[model samples]
Each structure stands twice: as structure tokens, then as C-alpha cells.
Target: MAATAIPSYNPSPRVEPLVQYRPLHPTFGAEATADFATITPDLVDEIKRGLAKYGVLVFRKTGLDDARHVEMSHLFGDLDDVAPFVSGLGQKNRLSSDYLFDVGNVNPDGSVMQPGTMRDLLLKCNYHFHADSAFNPRRAGISLLLAHELPPAHLGGETEFADTRSAYEDLSPDRKEEIKDWVVLNSQLQCRRNANTDKDGILDPLLDTDEFDPMKHRFGKHRLIQLHDPSGRTNLYIAAHAHHVEGMPIEEGQRKLKELLDHAGQPQYTFKVQWKDPGDLVVWDNTCVLHRSVPGGYAGKYKRDLRRTTVHDMGPQAWGLNGVGATWRSGLD
Candidate 1:
């Protein structure tokens, strides 16, 4: 007698649901609270669109490891190899890949840098408000900062961000017209020197040095204002890296830039994000915002480590930076 063969039955594949996005700020930025494992291709597209609309997107409770972080970064676009910037930070001070930009006060040996140390002094430069990779010809479209470890909220390690789009919108028509045809010259080292150099009859360098040269720094050119394509909005491009304005006197341009910066940083136009938990990822649009690290309780006493990845724009069009033939700027940060 022949026995009937039994058939194997397979259940239907589970569908990935859309994630929820709650606005964090009035003008720009949103918080995405979703399970990382459930993120699908459709959700990734939604996130890209959200980034375009909000200018900043944050993922809470991601708990992403190194591999997951890299995988998540690929959702926006191709990754930029920034290994040159990541190297020399010590073995544990950096990740295995050059793509990760380590931003922290902790040392490679799992220890915090002593206060007033050279590394600690270098971090002081971050106190100045500026966008990541603004000195690069192909500026970063999206910059991700994942909190690996954070000190107590009372310790004061907070990151502040200002909305450039809102600032541009509040500008007077005449002022907008004046800057419409203008361009800014950006220099990273020059900005760093400016912040560290002793001025106003006071010594401020983290380390003393007589050989201060601004001419030897790398520089780039960017529009005085960035016209975003998706939202059809204009955002001021002025940052700490913008040393001077093109086609204008150095002093006058600098004065105007200073004035613009002052106006843009109004309390109403800015918000502070407190990094209280690990695995919280903040993705910001560098083209439309200026961010800086607030002073922590103590550099060495507390463990505050945050890893970053600066993703280059999808080309000149992504940033509305003029034409497709734009060249990459030779700048270091």
C-alpha cells in the first residue's frame, strides 16, 4: 500500500508597518520612535522625505551597533569615506571603519581626558556654532550623531541647534535682496584659530603657540544663502567657518556676517537637545542648521562619547548649490 505524501504549509510573511514621526521643533526637526528591526525599504523612503521636510530627524531607542549604524546610514544615500578625519584618534577612540567620526571626551583606553588637556582644549572649539563639513566643497547633506554614552543631564553636555530656514524667513526683504547675489568664503582652520587665539587683551588658547597663520588654512566657496529644492525655502549659509564674503570688503562682510549670525541665534529660533540616553541618533541637515556642543560637567570625570557620520549630499542638486559642475572644496575640519 502507498501512503499519501503530506504537504508543508508556510505562513504569510509579516508586513513592516510605517513608523511614527513627531515634530520636535516648530520649524524643523522630528523624532522617530520605532523598532529598528521593523524598519523596511518603504519606511526608509519615508524617513528621507521626512528629513527633506523637517531638516532634522532623530531615532530614539535604536540601540544600533557598529554594523547597524552603517546599514542605517546607507538609507539616505552613498556614504562618504571620511577615514582621513577619523584616524589618529587612538584605537578605541575610533571605530573599526574610517566612516565614523568620533566626537567625545573619552579616550581610547576607556578613560576621560583630563580637564585642560590638549584634547579637552580642542573640544572647546566646538562651543562655536557651526555646521559639520561646511568647509567642504560638497557639503554634508545629513550628519548623524549617535549617543554612545552620556553624562548626567545636570552635568550640562547638551547640543544646541538653530534653524536657518526660520532665520532666513524672518529676514527683511531688502536684506534678503542684498545677500541674494553674495557668496561666502569658508575656512575651517581659520575658524579654529579664531576661536583659540588670544584676543580682546586676553589669553585663550588651550595650548600656547606663537606660530598662528590663517593663510595656511583650507578654504571654500558657498552661496551666502542655501535654496533648498524639496521645500523651496532659503536658509542662510553663514557659519563660523565663513571667514569673509566675496565681492565685499573683508571687514564689512565680516561685520554683516556677525550681524546675521546674531540674529539667527535668537532663542526663539533655536532649541537644545539633551543627550540623556544611549542609542539616540540625531540626523541633521547641515545645509540648513548650525549646531554646537555645550560645556559638560567635567571632561575627564564623566564619560560622554558620541559617534558621528557626515553623509555627503546627493550631488550639487541636493543642496541647490548652483550647477552640476561644482567642484569639491579642499578643506579640513
Candidate 2:
């Protein structure tokens, strides 16, 4: 019989530097090194920097409640008041505040929507690719979705993200030259109409064209190629909300939009993220990526609840002479 020697502990040991991010995808997507509770202002600044570099980040096992979710979202930037769109949607049971955007399959009464119904069909509209608040002039920079409730793995409620930045980079020189002068018109009315329209007829009968109003919904016209303010990188900003290229025929513009979307949707530029746990949080750059919810079978059978918070870009010119966040620095160097 041989006796094993026990190792003695040293008075002091070398401490390894903490890893901040782990890469999830080559083009865009990373996982945080620590828990959400340990995320301080400095770490948040680093996360912001990482977000500026990578298009998406996934934080796993963050057991955050509604109030904490809102608190953490504010560290990135000022929260957008999404009350208008969320107010009439549903129950406020899990919502920490009215401003939190509910991105879920659960009904207002904490029940799942039945399959093939109008509400179910409307939820299917999210299957199309789009950036959050793209039609608005005050575009969302980053969007964070926290998984409050998750469905069974077999049910499949994954989210797909396309890196528009990489997609733009992958374009051929000729294609780039052709689209350089193109301008895209993004409108909520156009987006809703496009979603409801199908091969034979409208999928959702409740969709009304008469209710379209510019005053009620946001709309904007932007160049096809968008430059990232922080990184100076060019990204394609086309989305479902984009109606057409200015001055081009409607049919031609739509064809071009579909072509670009198909190109961007390629497997190389797209990442389909599945929720492995209940507390998973996905943070992505809305400015450089288009995302969509995967419509799983029977929303009523599988319950998937999620909360989203958007952070607007805080560029100096963004808070110009009369902006809300800051006052003018007209003569500053």
C-alpha cells in the first residue's frame, strides 16, 4: 500500500486577469464572463465597447427580475419610453414598468395564444427580418432581450440575427457601386402591409390599410449604406420596414430589397440563437443587425416570455442644440 502526499497551500498565489468576453460567432456575438450582478459601470463601459465592436452578446444565467432588468438597461444609455406601443398589449404581471417592451408569446392573462388565430398570425409577422425602431428617426442603437420564461427545446422559439455590417462588407464591388446612391424609405404602414400580404391573399384579415397614419407611426428615409458612427464601418440598413428605393418603381424597389435580404440571410452572416435556459439575455446592436423571432408550433402549447429594452445612440450631434439629454456646446473645441 502506497500513501499519497498532500499538496501544501502557499501563503500568496498569482491571480489571473479576468476574461471579459467569450466569442460566440465570428462576425458578431459574444458571451459575458461574469454574472449580471457583477457588472459595474466600468464593466458596462467595456460591454458598450464590445457591443460597438461586435453586433451581439449573450449573457447566460442572469436571474434578473423586471426591476433589475430596467436598472441594468439604463447603464447602457437612456431608455426609450415604449409605453405607447406596449400599453394596450397585455398583462403587466411580469413587467417591472410600462416602458419595458414585452416580446413574448404569452397572452395578457398569462396564457399562450392559440395557433392559427388572428393573434397567432400577427405574431408570425415577426418571422420577417427587421431592425427595432428602424422607421423612427430616433433609431435604436442596442436592443436587449431577457428571457423571463422559456418553452421546451422541442418547441423551438429561437431568435435569428443577421449581421448587416458583414453582409455589406461581403457585397461585390459592382453591387456596392450600384447601391451607393440608393435611398430606402422605411415606414411602419409599409412594413405591416408587407407582412400581411402573401402569395394568394392576406394572411391576417384584421390588417386594415385605412388606419395608416404618418402622425401615429414613425417613418424615415435613409441611405442604403449606413456608416457606424463609432467604428466608421459601413453596414446595410435594409429591413422589412423598408418600402422602396427612392425614385425607383415600387416593384423594382421591392425586388431589390428582397434580393438584399436574401443575400444577408445567408448562413455565413446569420446566427440563430436558441434559449438554453430561462435567464438567458441577448443584447444586440440594432443599428448593424436585423433580427426576427422564429415562429414555433402552437404558441398556446409552448409558453415563451421575454422582455426587451432599447438604448438609443448618444452621439454629440444627436443631443444637438435643443435635444433632451444634453444642452448645446456650440463653441466647444
Cα TM-score per model: 0.85, 0.83
**lDDT per residue, candidate 2, 1-333, as tens digits?**
888889887778875433368777888877776556765777667677888887888878888777877888899897776555544444244465865777787776777778766565555657888887656555677888999778887778899999899999999999999999887767665666666777886535566534442234434666778687766789898888777778999789889999998898889988888888888888888878889998776367877888898887565322212224432111110
RMSD of 1: 5.8
In the range 134-178, model 1's lDDT, one tens digit per residue, is 676566778888998888889888888888899999999999998
Backbone clashes in model 2, listed as residue pairs: none
Model 2, CA-based lDDT: 0.73
C-alpha lDDT of all candidate models, in order: 0.73, 0.73
lDDT of 2 at 249: 95
Estimate the TM-score for candidate 1.
Answer: 0.85
User: Which residue pairs come into collision in candidate 1?
Assistant: 137-329
